[model samples]
Target: MARVTKPLSQTEIKAAKPQDKEYTLRDGDGLYLRIKKNGTKLWLFDYYRPITKKRTNMGFGAFPEVSLADARRRREEARSLLARGIDPQEHLKEQHASALAEAANTFSAVAERWMALKKTKVTADHAFDIWRSLERDVLPLIGALPITAVKAQTVIAALQPVQSRGNLETLKRLIQRINEIMTYAVNSGLIDANPIAGVRQVFQQPKKKHMPSISPEQLPELMSVLTTASINLQTRRLIEWSLHTMARPGEAASARWAEIDYDAKLWRIPGDRMKAGREHIVPLTPQSLAILEFMQPISGHREFIFPGVKDPKVPMNSQTANMALKRMGFGGTLVAHGLRSLASTTLNEEGFDPDLIEAALAHIDKNEVRRAYNRATYLDRRRKMMEWWSEKITISS
Candidate 1:
C-alpha cells in the first residue's frame, strides 16, 4: 500500500493538477480531493470498518462549494463517528433522507393537501371561493418559495393588494389561511416557525366593518315590501325562513327537506354544512313552520327546501335573496349577512343571553371554553329566543 501523505493545500492541489487525467490525493487521515479530467475538483473522504474489513467513500461536495478547510472539518466529524463505533456512511444516508423529506414539504404542496382534505366537507360554492382566492392572491407570490423561506414580510406583501382595495375582511381571512398553511408546514418539519404567527399585531389598521343592519323597528316595513315584491315564491320563503329562524341565508337556502322534522319543529343542520363545523339545531317557530308547510306542497323528495328556480339540483342562486331586497328598493341598505347581524343585534337588545343569540344565528365563538360549553348549554334558550323573534317579525295586519 502507498504511504499516507499530509492533507494537500488548495494552492498545492491546484499546482498538482494533471494535464489529461483525473487524480485523487489522499491525506492519511481519510480526507482527499479529486481533480477531474475536465478540471472540476471535488472534496471526498474515505474510511474503513475494522470489524467488517470494508471501505466507505463519501463526497463532501464540489470544490469552491465546500472549501478545503470545511472538507477537513467534516473528515474530523467522520473520524469522531468511527471512534464511537458508528458507520459514517450510514449516518450520512440517514441525514440525507431527513433533509430530502423536509425539502419536499413546501407551502404550495402543503396548502394544496389541506384544501383537498377540506373541500369535500364544505359547500361547493364556499370551496370554490376559497380555492379561487388562493389561486389569485396567495399562490402567485409565495407558492414557489420554500416554507422555511416564507418570511412575515412575504405574507404582508401577498395581502397588500387585497388591503389596498378596501377588502380588509378578505385580507384578514387570507392571512388566517396563510397562517394555517405555514403552521402545517412547521408541524411537518418543513419550516421552523409560522411566519404569520402574531401577524395581526403588525396590521394594526382595522377593517371597515359592513354597515349595521336596519333596526327591528324598520324590519316590519322591510318585510311588508318583500312580501308583495315581484320575486319568486321561493325567494319570499327564503327571506321569511332567514328572519324567523335567524339562521344564515346559506343555511336556509341549502336546507334539505330531510333535515327538517316538521312534527318535532326542528331543523338539524349537519356539521359539514355549517361554517362552525358543528351540527346546529334550529327550532322552527310557528311562523317558520307555516312557511315550511306552504313549501311542503312544492318541495319534492329529490330537491332542496329552497331549490333554484332554474336548477332544482342546486340550492337557490346566491344572489336570489339579495336581488329580491334590491328590487324592493332596499339595494345597498341590506345584505344576506346583514340579516344575521340584524337578528343578533335586535335579539341582544331584547335582553336575551348573548350566548343564546349567537347560537340562534349559528355563529362560532373562537373562545375554547365558550365553544365547549355553549355547544351543550344554550339549546333550550335559543329555541325560545328564535320563537319570540318569529312572533315579532310577523306582519300584524
Candidate 2:
C-alpha cells in the first residue's frame, strides 16, 4: 500500500522562502509552487502526455497574483482534459490559434489590410472617403462576419437600403469598393474567391448623363454674369479658377497652396485627388494666378487655396461652385464639372492639338505608351492653349 500525499496549507505556503537553488513544494495532485533562488514564485502543473506518456510541466501563472486556489483550479482543468485523452498544452495551443484565426479573418480586419495596400496608391483624402463609405455603408452590416461566410445574398441585403434611397451612384460605388475588398481577401488568402463579383449587377445602374455644360458660345455670357453675381467673392473666384484650370469641381475645391508651382506656373494635383488616379499638372494662366493673389489675404495661411468660409481648416465643398453658378441663373444649365467640357469645346474648335488638349485635361489614354508621351511632351503646348483659353474666359475681355 502507498502513502497518500498531504495537501499544502496556505500558512505553510506563505512562510516558504527562497534558497540557493530553485525548489518546488507539492500542493496536491500535480499542482506545485516553484520558488526560484531569486524569490520568484511560479505556479506549475506536472503531467504526462496522453499519447506519448512523457511527463510535461505546464505553467499556470506566477504566485501571489495566481494564489494557491487559482493554481488548484487550473490543475483540475488540466486533469479533466488529460482524463479525456487530450493533452492540455495542445488544447491550449489550439484555442490560441482559433482565436487568432477568428480575429484575422473578419471582414473588417481583412478590409483594413486591403485599405493599407490602397493608401500607397491613393491620396489621404481619398483614403479617408473610402473608409468612411465603408463605415457608413458596409461595416455596420457585415464587418464582424468571417470573410468566407459572406455570400452575395448577404451583401445584397446590406446594399438594398442604399438602392432604395435612389442614390444609384453611391450604391454603385459601394458595390465596386466591396468587390475590391473581397478580391483583396482572395489575394491575401483570407478567402478562396470573391463572393461579390457580380454584386454590381444586383443594383440598377446610374444614368450616364454627361456633366451638364453650356456650349462654347454661352461661356462669354456666363462670365459676364459671374462678374456681378450675387454670390460671395471666394465662390466666384473658385468658379473662375475651375474654368481656367479645367479642373474637376472636386479637384479645384481641394486645391492646396503647396501644390502650386508658382515659378513654373503649374499646379501639380496629386493622383489621389484626381479622378484619373494620376498626378495632373495644370498650366496656370495669368487669370488663374490673379485669382490666387486675390485669395492671399483670405486664405494664404491655410492649407487650401479655397478654404471654406465657415471652417478654414477644410477645403471648400466641391458643390460650392455649382451652387454659385445656380445663384447666377445657370441652375441645371451648367455644373462646376461642366467647365471642362466648355474648355474642351472652345479649344478643339480653335484648332489646338487635340492630344495636347487631352493632356491638359488629364484624360488617361487607352494606349499606355502614347499616354506617357502625352503627359511628357504636351506641357509647353498645353500652357499656350491654357493661356488662350484663359484670355477667352477673361472677365475683362
- Tens digits of per-residue lDDT, candidate 2, 217-302, equal 88878988888788889998899899889987888999999999999988999887877679999989989999999999999999
Model 1, residue 203: distance off in Å is 4.2
Candidate 1 lDDT tens digits, 108-197? 878898788667677656777788899999898888776777888888877778888877777777887888777777776776777679
Lowest-lDDT window of 10 residues in candidate 1? Answer: 204-213
Each candidate's lDDT (Cα)? 0.80, 0.89
User: Distance (Å) between predicted and true CA of 318, model 2?
Assistant: 1.7
Q: What's the lDDT of the predicted structure labeled candidate 1?
A: 0.80
lDDT of 2: 0.89
Candidate RMSDs in order: 6.9, 6.2
Task: Give, for candidate 2, the lowest lDDT window spanning 10 residues.
Answer: 388-397
